[model samples]
Target: MMKEISLEGKTALVTGGASGIGYAIASEMIDAGAEVVIVGRRADKLQEATEKLGDRCRWYQFDVTHVDEYDQLLNQVDEKSPVDILVNNAGINIKKDFFDFRAEEFDRIVETQAKAPFMLSQAVAERMKERKSGNIIFISSLATILGMHEIQAYTVCKSGVKGLARSLARDLGPYGIRVNSLNPGFVYTDMLEKTNLKTPERLKEIEEKTPLKGFTQAKDLGMAAVFLASDAARFITGIDLVVDGGISSSFLI
Candidate 1:
């Protein structure tokens, strides 16, 4: 018999949970019986998501890039419920030629996608260590594996997230904390629509290239996350789970 997948007693903290992939993860976690705390920089988005997620959902409006404020945010959430899962899904992208990319722009992406997750994990892991259990998920990208153009900063930081997960998994394993990263491929989201899927040709190209001949939806990643966070994936750690519909394995003939 297959082990039942459930997060009945877990409380998850998902950054960037206001919309897109993050919001999908929050919704999926709630469906799997986990209370979700959605965090983002916008109050309006948080409020809207909270209402849609029902009573098991809560909202915290804070920028994850603000490293110093993580403790305060954690304290506030911990006061109500200790965080059992942390999804580092908040990210930003700047599309430009590598030659034209500025150092500051690279730093901004790194700070948000890479540094913020590291810092937040450190803070949450401390609490989990006390209890000897936790789960951490990093939202990486297939860009780290495939050669993608005009998103060097995003690719670099996302790659770094995988490295962070491996190292953290090793360090936290003894404490029963599992760290893993999910690499999504060509997911259809508001961000993707604005950046990568701007043109019909580009969209068609992506579909044709993917072995599954379609784009991965936000909920696909959400379900993958629920699997990783649940006891079903209890022994999984230090790995990058690719939920990209086989695109990573396909090649142009």
Candidate 2:
């Protein structure tokens, strides 16, 4: 097997990286020898993730919605070393009936998932465009393409992420900066476990719906993130890689 993926000297900044999928991505980059900085709003979780990822990983306490600080944050963290990879994985989901969904919930999800990533990409993109090399990846959800009973806000926001990736890839292609989106369907994270999804019936239902007959693991997502951020994906840009088990609800319906 030829080794085409490597993050030897790259630096990755992951938002909402204190736990769940974000932390997994940070850990993957660190394991691959990339300097990693995990950002989150909570200081305690940030500290915990930093400790878990060890030396190559550091923690930054900053709210992704705090639009005021994002402009100067990338430069502050990577003043000497340019950030080679950016993973905008921070997002919030409100599980509520569509009619029950308030305007505020919609705004929050859009702020964290769509706007913050857009602005932060712009922030790091300037440096990447200047250096003529970089990778930007967004972790989108399957709901972006389907109708869910709840989580309407999250779905809409992720839909924007996919759209952003498409436009950004075209806009940044000239500068040698790659922009892409990774759509992971029902990845089992610590947060998901908290949903009390341990029932055998629920598991079977999920497995049956998915062609692969199993849920996506967070570590799998981590590896995917690292690969997209690596030189192996150099020719790949503006593509959305779906990590689902091939149910293709979006296609069938």
Candidate 3:
């Protein structure tokens, strides 16, 4: 008999949960019996998502890039329900030549992807330490290892996110908190469709390269997040869980 993975009685706060991968994570967690708070900058998107997610899900309109407002956001959420799981999934990617990358553009990416997660994790970890339990999941990218072109700043930020997860896992383990990261590969999201998969040939090329010979779905990463957040992964921490459909494992001859 197999034990079931459940998140009953837990409350998860997922950043960027209005759409794409974040929405999938929020939906999966809610399905796994968790009460979820979806955070995003757009009120309309958040409202639409929460409606689609049903009663177990709610929304908060806030920009994660505004680092100064993290505490305020946390306090508001904590007042309603303490966050048992934190998913740092909010990020932006600006593709440009390495030489053409401006300092300001790099800073913007870092502020959203790297610095926001760090600060939010720190704040949530402090609260978790009080209860001696919590879970933090960073949404990293497969580009960190695969090294995609024209996304130098994005790659750097995502690489830092993985490092943050490892370091936080070590630091927060004693407090009964688990820190981990998920590296998604070629997910068929609006972002990918708008950016990388503009041409069917390009899409086919990527799919062929992946050992699974397909694109990863957003729900795939969501289910992975649910497992990590549930008791099933109680003993797991400080690991980068690659949800790339075996892309990382293959090499062309």
Better of 1 and 2 by TM-score: 1
Lowest lDDT sum, 10 consecutive residues, model 3, at 1-10
TM values, all candidates: 0.97, 0.92, 0.96
Candidate 2, run of 10 with poorest lDDT: 189-198
Candidate closer to the true structure by TM-score (higher is better), 1 or 3: 1
lDDT of 1 by residue, 1-253 (tens): 1345888889999999999999999999999999999999999999998999999999989998988998899999999899999999998998889999999998998899889999999999999999999999999898888888788889889989999999999999999999999888888898887767788988888888888888998999999999999899999999999998898887761
Which lDDT values do the candidates have, in the order given?
Answer: 0.92, 0.83, 0.90
Q: State the lDDT of candidate 2 residue by residue for 1-253, as single tens digits.
A: 1256879888999999999889889998888879998888999999988988998888778988887787567767876467999999987766767888788878887898789998888888988888999999988877776665567777788888898999999999999999899988777776555442557787677777787778888888898898888888888998888888786653432
Write the number of the candidate with greater lDDT, choosing between 1 and 2.
Answer: 1
**What is the TM-score of candidate 1?**
0.97
Query: Which candidate achieves the best lDDT against the true structure?
Result: 1
| Clash list (residue pairs), candidate 2 | none
Compare candidates 2 and 3 on TM-score and give the better one: 3
1-253: candidate 3 lDDT, tens digit per residue: 0244888889999999989999999999999999999998899999999999999998889988776787898898888789999999998888778999899989998899899999989988889999999999999888888868788888889999999899999989999999999888889888767656678888888888888788899999999999989888989999999998788887740
After superposition, the stretches of candidate 3 with alpha carbons farther than 4 Å from their true spots are 1-4
In candidate 1, clashing pairs total: 0
- Residue pairs with colliding backbones in model 3 are none
Clashes of each: 0, 0, 0
